[model samples]
Target: MTTGQIAIIVLILLGAGFMLISAIGIVRLPDVFSRMHAAGKASTVGISCLLLGAGFFFLDEFLFYRMIVLIALIFATAPISTTALARAVYNNEPALRRQLRHDEMAGSVAEAISAPPADGDDAILTTPS
Candidate 1:
């Protein structure tokens, strides 16, 4: 009914919508990369809108600044962190269990682990030294 009430409603709607859409994306997406995209987009926007709007509703300058800073922190870290996690999973996924063909790094660890023992000159000697 009031302007403040309207703003609060709008903020809630925006945050809820983003979260719901993200949930759908996570459930409906076909693979790891796409799911990560969906989660990152929804959560970042949802947190920014929700925290920023709560700051406005609270009418405190410190709260507002804190909310904005928190949003900035999320944006600064969430995507890159999530992307790296996804990349790690993609790169190190189990060979026999993974269905993906784009994993060039998938077998790197396995190859290293399975490689034959190096000869005397090539092997490291840690005795006493």
Candidate 2:
């Protein structure tokens, strides 16, 4: 096989390996936050690598650009979405709060949870009005 083919295979295998580890982490983790962390970080990298391999294999300018865009989107959105989901889950689920050891967001999240909803707003994390 050509060097390029070998490189493509390596990227695919690396991506698949990361995905496999992420799947295992999601299944084995004890909490929703941990599982989300695993799914978010590892899957983003795995999908990016897989897309890169596919882009190389196709060698079409249009498709390659699309693949790059997809990778960028995944990298850009995964962490933000993960953080939002974590915050939402933490605010909604009291049991999850007890599992935290450090509680870095304690002050902010606690304030948000306890603060009374503003006029026409019922969300837990409310903005100052």
Candidate 3:
């Protein structure tokens, strides 16, 4: 009924909507990469929004700081975890690329790790080859 209550309701609805959409995306997407993109990215946003809404509803200064810190931590580490999971999945299935739209880290990391230039094989000495 009140304005503040209305705002909290709207924020919660938006967050829940994003989470539901992301869940659908994971289930309906054609491939693993697309599913990861949806679930990983959208869920992070949804959770942040939910926390933000809860912060306002709780109406406490300390709680607000805690909410902000939680959101910050989510923003900080989520992408790294998502990338690591994606890379793990990709290593086991090279064919993942065929279904993906545009893979920025397609070959470089894997190639660099799989076969490094040997010291004796390449013989790329600083002084002489």
Candidate 4:
């Protein structure tokens, strides 16, 4: 096999390994936050690597550009979405709060939760007006 072929195989294997680890992490983690952390980080990397390998294997300009765009999108959005999901889950679930070792957003979350409604309605709105 050519060197390019070998490199593609190696990258694919590495990507698959990362994805497998992500799956294991989702199953083994104690809480939703930890599982989201594992899935988000690992899946982003794994998918990027897999796309990179496919680009190399195809060796086409169009595919390479597409792969780069996809990788960039994943890198840009994954963490933000993960953090948002974690924050929402953290705020909604009281049980999960006890499992946290350190919560940097604790003050803000508590303030948001406890603050009275601006519109004098019973339902509190977390979103800024």
Candidate 5:
């Protein structure tokens, strides 16, 4: 086999390995946050590597552009999606919330939970006299 083919195979194997580890992490982790963390990081990199390998193997203009767009989309959205998922888990799952060592959004949560509703009739507006 050519060097390029070998490199492609290696990259694909490495990507598969990362994906396997990510799957294991999702299964083994104690909480949603940790599982998301593992899956988000590992899967993003894994998919990227796999795409890179495919792109290298194919080496066409259309394929290259598609791969670039896919990679960019993954890079842009993965972290945002992970954060959103974690926040949803945090909001919805009390049991998992307790497993967290530090509650970064605790104050915001408390404030939101404690804040009273603002009724139109209760609004106090003062104009500069």
Candidate 6:
């Protein structure tokens, strides 16, 4: 086989391996946060490598560009979505929050949780005298 073909195979295999590891992590991990972390980081790399391999296989300009865009979008959004999900889970699940060994968001989360919900009568939206 050609070197290009070999490289594509390697990329695809590596991507599959990463995705498999991510799946294992999600299943084996003790907590929701760890599982989400595994799913977020490993799956991003896995999907990117898979897309790269596909782009190489097709070697079409349009497909190549689309692959690049897909990789970029995954990299851009994965962490953001993961963090948002984690925060949502943490805020909603007290038991999950207790499982955290080191939480940088503890202060902010505590304050947010303790803070009273704002009503529509707040001065921020009202005209000042």
**Candidate-wise lDDT, in order:** 0.71, 0.83, 0.78, 0.81, 0.78, 0.81
- Between candidates 3 and 4, name the one with more favorable lDDT: 4
- For residue 127, model 2's alpha carbon misses the true position, in angstroms, by 18
Better-scoring candidate (TM-score), 2 or 3 = 2
> Model 1 misses residue 36 by how many Å?
0.8
Question: Model 1 compared with the native: what TM-score?
Answer: 0.69
Q: Which digits, one per residue and each the tens of the lDDT, describe model 5 over residues 1-129?
A: 999899999999999999999999999997777788889999998998899999998999899789989999999988898877876666556666656677666545534433333563212121111
In candidate 2, position 89 carries an lDDT of 88
Candidate 1 accuracy as lDDT: 0.71
Per-residue CA lDDT of candidate 3, range 38-105, in tens? 99988988998899899999989999999999999999999998988886666556566545566665
Q: What is the TM-score of each candidate against the true structure?
A: 0.69, 0.83, 0.78, 0.82, 0.79, 0.81
lDDT of 2 at 2: 100
Model 6 ranges off by over 4 Å: 113-129
Report the C-alpha lDDT of model 2 over 12-93, residue by residue, as the tens digit: 9999999999999999999998999899989888998899999999999999999999998888888888888987887776
Count: clashes, candidate 4: 0
Q: Quote the lDDT for 32 in model 1.
A: 75
Which scores greater on lDDT, model 1 or model 5?
5
> Order of all candidates by lDDT, from best down to worst?
2, 4, 6, 3, 5, 1
After superposition of all CA atoms, the RMSD between model 1 and the true structure is 8.8
- Span of ten consecutive residues with least summed lDDT in model 5: 120-129
Where does candidate 1 have its weakest 10-residue lDDT segment?
120-129
> Candidate 6, residues 1-129: lDDT per residue as tens digits?
999999999999999999999999999998888889888989999999999999999999999999999999888888898888876786666666656677676556545554433663332222111
Tens-digit lDDT track of model 4 for 1-129: 989899999999999999999999999998888899789989988998899999999999999999999999989988888878976776666667756686666556546666554676533233221
Rate residue 23 of model 3 by lDDT. Answer: 96
